[model samples]
Target chain A: MTLALPAAEAARELVEPVLREAVARLDPLTARVARYHFGWADSDDRPCAGGGKALRPTLAVLSGRAAGADVERCLPAAAAVELVHAFSLLHDDVMDDDPVRRHRPAAWTVFGRSHALLCGNALLTLAGELLLEQETPGCAAAARALNEAALSLMAGQALDLEFQGRDDVTREECLRMSRCKTASLLACACSIGVTAAGGPASLAGSLAAFGAEAGLAFQLADDLLGIWGSTEATGKPVLADLRTRKKSLPVVAALTGPTAAGRRLAELLARPEPLAESDLHDAARLVEEAGGRAWAEAETGRRLDAATRHLDEADLPADVRAEFLHLARFIATRDH
Target chain B: MTLALPAAEAARELVEPVLREAVARLDPLTARVARYHFGWADSDDRPCAGGGKALRPTLAVLSGRAAGADVERCLPAAAAVELVHAFSLLHDDVMDDDPVRRHRPAAWTVFGRSHALLCGNALLTLAGELLLEQETPGCAAAARALNEAALSLMAGQALDLEFQGRDDVTREECLRMSRCKTASLLACACSIGVTAAGGPASLAGSLAAFGAEAGLAFQLADDLLGIWGSTEATGKPVLADLRTRKKSLPVVAALTGPTAAGRRLAELLARPEPLAESDLHDAARLVEEAGGRAWAEAETGRRLDAATRHLDEADLPADVRAEFLHLARFIATRDH
Candidate 1:
């Protein structure tokens, strides 16, 4: 993956130091939890190699570059976006009761839940602090963008939680939730990076549209992996979403379809008891037979095409365009 | 309380509308939870009278007034402070597993922990949004102050959680935690109010000092109530602190004291089983016999005096001085 997009490594290098400095501002315990959650260290605070792909930060850096800004000027915006992302992940893991993240135990699993909650609060506060620390012309605008995205992300998560109790979640509702939960912050990262670099608002708009589509497609790929990807590749249990009956894109598509397999999948999901391994396997098969997997695949390609179209509209230099296309493609097709 | 300090009512009137408007921006489910948490609605979404004293928002309004800013100009700052307070209470109740707040069931108890958590996230985000929406010169400074207070508050909360497992908590460490958890936000409320109104930094500084002292005094009063106040008055279970083995100011003071009663109190708190009702009663008596109650009372008075001294140094109008002093005294001496 690093070989496929060397820019990811560069973005990590540019943003990780800033993230470390910001997280260090936290109280000792919270900072320790944050460091471990970011995969910079193990639960015992030993150094480790378990970090995410830094995809959002890469998008932020790329957006700044497309706007002809130096990487230094983009540092705060990039780090702020990643901090918000981390904050959401920490809270989401707790809310969802998931035990894994970035191929490692979730922060809440290692630390206590309350400590993880405080760490999430600290990270969100740090994100605002980072934007405010920058004395650039675009600092306030960047802060506004980040706040808007955070609010939208929370709203999306709320809807996702609401879906857990109901068996009638529609495909449109699922997409809206995904847009709020996943796409808003990605769009904010792109727009805020350009804004932080004092880029033109028009360029930021195009990049934002590009990011929204790419983010949705990225979520579709994630949903696919949740149901069928190898545990080794995804670093999560196989068919985890099926076992939990998560209302992900593919699951919603399958449940809402008019096929007999779709009806059977819905009935399986509505059961009171936890799904067994066999039941989960059967449910996954039903979802595929009902065309959920194929629909999600098609939707991913369509969204990717739309994202590339927006990038084309930006009239970027060839290298910048190539980098964005490669990144968008990766987001739409990654196993993890 | 309202008759004794009309400013409290005035502040509520000024800030509640702004808070409502901000909360209305959240997703429907979150907005409902927030409305209930704010005491603007019940669990069933009906109107309710249950609410806190709005002390933090009142402090903000009074600080703005002392700086010659109109009540209108102070709305954002006042509401932002209250929102942060609400955010903290929601998260704290969840973390502490408290069953009640403001003479009503805690939001987490009524609506589930995840919903309450998301509502806290929403409120915190709304606070930042309120500050940013203000286009005044002092808006950035106000946001910075709020973020700093929030960070300090989380640090304080982290330490408090850390203290739960350790039997060796020092008085100094406990005081530091109280300053971070309680006083920092109060000071921020004062300073941010002035900053939002474009007041002099010197005035903000004096008001912040006053608020910090008063806030500590307020915590002492709360700790006293946690042990002795009637459930009807305090809106919490009597002897709640002892039952939970909470390391509140009084308990810490008692545990660190040199008396035999203090040593006995430590032994009781260290036992693994849940403290029975009789054990809680015994622990309360031990804390008092160890002079914890007396010390907390004297310290509250001293802090109140220090608060008034800072207010005197500010050279406010006679009416403003009287208002601040009345509020400070009320805070130090309140039974609930």
Candidate 2:
């Protein structure tokens, strides 16, 4: 946890300038949208201070460092990952109809949905252009990784939206969606960092394995926070997922569980009207009673352990391994 | 026009299979959405016969042929351009809220806006991946061209949307938007086709100039049809752009003209209520009286002439030059 803030800050310091440069390559209108979305500008186009946590870029740069590359050499790959993350968030916020992001109105709410969508696409294109401009063989491999992860991310989002309309979403289906939605990009970030650093495919594979496990753990923690974390800590309303009847891991686990509480949870969720505060509380209790909370907490520990094993097995210096572990642990246990 | 239909058919036969194969890579839910968007599948998930004109792909393949390469070497580039075109159309439909495309309900209308947007993104990623998988150095240049064109296209769309709210859009601004939104992709298509065929940058440059001029001519023709063509030809209600108050080239020219007809046209367009059928006819007449239609017609002819001159100067076989001219003329004069 201690290394987490410093690692993110360092990554942001190196990558944000490159990201800004890439966004500036867009047309003035699109550039304004990109700046506002990235928290470099407010809705009125003034400078702001609400950028992202830079977690993905941190992983990219650290993974490169662990593979014996200089930080400057990793800047393009790191910035690419951060741009992809921002692109997905922009589109996902519009699709999910969520009105807030990072303690402010979402980009779609500020700029309108069409502009947000177009700007997201512009960022994505810029991400690829950044890698291509590097003109290195390793950059080509990194670009391929980014493309594969982007495809998986879109497919995962499609599934997530599809699940919203159905009550029969299975645990396996939810797991698959989560793997694509969260783990694939994280895995790509780790692997592409090393790939861009001229690491062998085998080494990238090991790092990717570590990242995927850590990513799942992060998702579990995120879902738990959706139900129980403080609004200040999570930048969302308390029990926000339940109020929106989101089919997160715990909710799906409880919905498909073999218990009376599970059936009641489903019934509560199936009602056509929006859930009242009392109903949201009742649903949270039912999810716990059906053993969903216990299962998720235990599974999170298992994933974290698997992730640590990956780092332990990778041929990295002790300090590099510690940094990876600190980052994984920090994301999985942030304020919870 | 005789060569036009045959060339398009040839390109479709070569490129559609590859395009279909690339789309098949998406996860099932997303793949379904993609299939629907491409007109390979109906809304009920059954196979359908409705697809695009394959104009961009034809241009890509023909440009390669004109650059002294075999058609097989150009398939990937052709498919990549087609995918980019489809991606833009998907997003553009959502942004413009146009309910139809190519004689059918638009993808956003049938699959919902969110799925349409995601599927569009999926196609875009697929386009880049298609280039990378070729493993040829020429494909790298093609990828760069595609990325640049995609960015310009987005910028143009943003401007187009911004113009929807304003009454002071200049003729220069409209021309710039048309260049970015329409000409850029077509230029990329021609340049990438030549680049992918191992042609020099100079050759690609000439073909891109030809394609850009042809593309502007195509846009001018399309805008005219938007105002005057039959539904059977343009696949929308008559005067569709007028109904939506689209600031197309001729409309902008008329609105900014120094004639009384121009002033009357502006007042008519600025009214809050929807225009009646008679009003649409009157507006169309005003555009003509104000010299907008005459100006656009003359410009289209000039662009087509320039495009043909570029083809004549390029070191292409006689038949290849003829084919390119035929395609350009066909698009510029379709059903007009």
Candidate 3:
């Protein structure tokens, strides 16, 4: 996904140094694991151009500006949110047993499960340490927000794990899990910026709402990509989610869809054997035919609209609001 | 181990409800996992009598009193320390791939590794949440201490994992691991009480030192029990550490000793086959013959003495000093 918005790009650049400094505070062993995971260095500690898009930190920076706070003053909040994101990624890799992330072998694959797990724990504590180090007017409130978000994130992950290999998982359960697993941290990322800046609680709450909707849209789009996006773009094999039998949004929607195609999809999924390449191709087509693709597309648009409404209600400065608008659009439309 | 000291018993009783309340703050799924792990409930949620001796929380409460604060005011800090300890146990069980804990199936065995891991993460965040809820004097300092301890604890666990299946691990490395994995949290437990109570830095530092030495003594004693203690008393299989080829203090001591028995012990450990009962017995005998048993005993005594000296140097009230001394002795002497 291209970051066409110069302001978003600038915010990401602004957050990079703060994120590096915060991660650098970990002990040597954990720091190596974290740095390798972040794509800052290879497993051997050589430099590599690897890492996520820094979307969450940019959201924090923009939210701080939208709340009339200096972006510099909101840096700790930005770093804390990014650290939480990294912590989740590390743990999620282990939980999903994913072999690859960001087009490379996952951290757990390189460092071993135990080291990856401990490094994730260390990163989590470091997030709290960074927030406490802020030592500013609203640091306590920001810390509280971050901790609450972290609890919800883990709870969401528990629910996701619970849903695995279960045939009865409902659409409502999937949506709630998504909210907890993805949306909660993103919402916190938006709100913590405002709280750190000592902005009005109302604005913070509104931004959180905005972010929650944006996060849902983001996840829905990702679910679509998991099944239908190009392998070259996603850095994953074709229909990788289908191969793993992952009950992602689109798959769940298709399984629960009250149609012949949906029933056929269920029968295909319930087979004891692993899905072959031909089976995956058929499953993808069945998901599309079962209205899963259309449903997710509609939901993504609906959530994006809801997110924009929250942003509008937040009454941000015109320029800041436009920047947020661009970001929300980017999240909803990004292909990779 | 019986709590013969009246004050130690009182401190434990006082901290129990606070710990329960802090854990109760977790979301329903994580709470169920944590409750099951703590032996508060069976896997099916039926009531059960389970859990560790509330050692860490009692230490926090007693340390607060020794630092000239009311035990009631130290409840949050006490609960936070206990939660951290429980978090470590849950994750450690996963890392060790152990099947039982406290004479029951381990949490990961019942709930699966993902649930246990997430529950541990939830408990950790809850500790931060509990400390933040205090909003009283010195809360930030207490939170900082807890975070630091958590980082050290994870680092220590990483080191322990690294040492596994490796024969070259040194005595110094084992001691450093013990300090980080066990003593760091204990030290935090002690210092957090003083920080929570707004006590002097000197007293806090001294109490932390006392706890560090006590923790080392406690671990050394535990290593002895792992080899020679009764199965009924320790609620573990005979020579459990040796069965797992764990590089505990005594084992490392035996391996590094410059003697024929030590060399023989190393050869036995290097074998690919699992140790039979007779092999375990022989290994135990060799450890003693190689002077591991005597060395650990002497070191435990030295640490206990050093711990007592730190406690005395803190200038606590005579009554409080007596209680701390009694607790330290109990820790070094406990079997189960």
Residues B217-288, candidate 2: write the lDDT tens digits.
989998999898898888899999899999999999999989999999999999999999999999999999
- Candidate 1, residue A84: Cα displacement in angstroms equals 0.6
Worst 10 residues of 2 chain B by lDDT: B1-10
How far off is model 1, as Cα RMSD?
A: 1.7
* Candidate 3 C-alpha lDDT tens digits along B1-336: 445566656766787788778778777878888889887899898988756777788788877887778878988898888889989999999999988888888899998899899989988998888888776548777888999999989989988888995889999999999999999998888778899888999999999999999999989999999999888757789898999999999999999989899999999999999889999999999999999999999999999999988987898888778877777888888763
Candidate 1, residue A209: Cα displacement in angstroms equals 1.3
Q: Which ten residues in a row have the lowest lDDT in candidate 1 chain A?
A: A1-10
What ordering of candidates by TM-score runs from best to worst? 2, 1, 3
- Tens-place lDDT per residue, model 1, A29-146, is 9999999999999999998886777888888888888888888888888999999999999999999999988777899999989999999999999998898877555877788889
Report per-prediction Cα RMSD to one decimal. Answer: 1.7, 1.6, 1.8
Model 2, A94-184: lDDT tens digits are 9999999888899999899989999999999988989988877788778888999999889889999999999999988988898899999
- Model 1 misplaced regions, further than 4 Å: A1-4, B1-4
Model 1 C-alpha lDDT per residue in residues B25-49, reported as the tens digit of each score: 8889999999899888999999877
Tens-digit per-residue lDDT, A1-336, candidate 3: 436567757767887788788777776888899999988999898988757777888888887887788988888898889888889989999998998888889999999998889888988898888888776548777888999999989988888887876998888899999999899998998788899888999999999999999999988988899998888767789898899888899899988989899999999999999888999999999999999999999999999999999987887899888877788888788773
TM-score for each predicted model, relative to the true structure: 0.97, 0.98, 0.97
